[model samples]
Target: MPSLRIMPKVMTLTDAAAARVSALIAQKPGVKALKIGVKKGGCAGMEYTMTWAEEIGKFDEIIEEKGAVVLIDPAAMMYLLGTEMDYKTDKLSSQFVFNNPNQKSACGCGESVNLEPATPPGFAPAEA
Candidate 1:
C-alpha cells in the first residue's frame, strides 16, 4: 500500500500564546474559539484581524494546543502557513505577535504588514 502524505498546519502557537488564549476565552462564557484572518485596509496592504468566535466556520483551519483553540479563516491560510503565534509582554504593553514566513514588510506604526502567499513544499507555480 502507498503511504499517504501528511500536510503541515497553517499556523501554530507558542506556550505563551496558548496560555493567553486560554485565559481570554475563560472570561466569556460559551466562547468557542479565537478566529484569525487578514483584512485589506492597512497602509501596508494588510492587517490581521482577531475575534472571539462563538461558532466555527465550515472551512476554517483549526489549531488546538495546550487548551487553546484557534480558527484560521480559510482566506488567510495561504498567507499564514508556517506562521507561529506568540504572546509577548513588556513594561509598556502586551500583545499577540505573528511570526510569519510570508511577511514581506510592515508599516511604520506596526499596525499593518505586507504579506505574500506561502508556497507549500513541492508546489510549483503553474506556467502562465
Candidate 2:
C-alpha cells in the first residue's frame, strides 16, 4: 500500500515555459528534468541558473505540471517563491524569463537580479 502526502509548491511555470521544457527533455539524450537555481555573480549580484538535470538530488523540490518536470534547488526556494517562468521570442532574440514579484531590482543588461525572499500571501511583515 502507498500513502498520499500533499506537499507545498515552491514555484510555478507559464504554459510556454512548460512546453519549451518538455521539448528540451525530448531532444536531449538521457535527460530527466530541468534544474533551476540562483547563483552569486553578474552585475546585479545574483543570476538565475538553469541546466539539464539527469537525476533528482536528495533535497531538490520537484514541480511537475503541463507535461514537464522541474527540479528547483533547495537553496533557491525562498528567493524563487511565487515566480512564473516563461519562454519568450522575438526577432532579436529568444530566451526563458522569470517574472518574480520578490525581485527587488535588476541590472541594466537584464542578466541578473537582486531578489528579496517572497512573503506568504495575506501575511504582513513586522515593522522594526
What is the lDDT of every predicted structure here? 0.95, 0.90
Question: Clashes in candidate 1: how many?
Answer: 0
Give the per-residue lDDT of model 1 (tens digit) for 1-128: 99999989899999999999999999999899999999897899999999999999999999999899999999999999999999999999999999999999999999999998888889985465
Residue 59 of model 2, lDDT score: 97
Best by TM-score: 1
Give per-residue CA lDDT, model 2, range 27-95, as digits (tens).
999999999999998888899999999999999989998999999999999889888899999999989
Identify the runs in model 1 with alpha carbons over 4 angstroms from their true place.
1-3, 126-128
Candidate 2 has a TM-score of: 0.86
Give per-model TM-scores: 0.94, 0.86
Error of 2 at 127 (Å): 11
lDDT of 1 at 58: 95
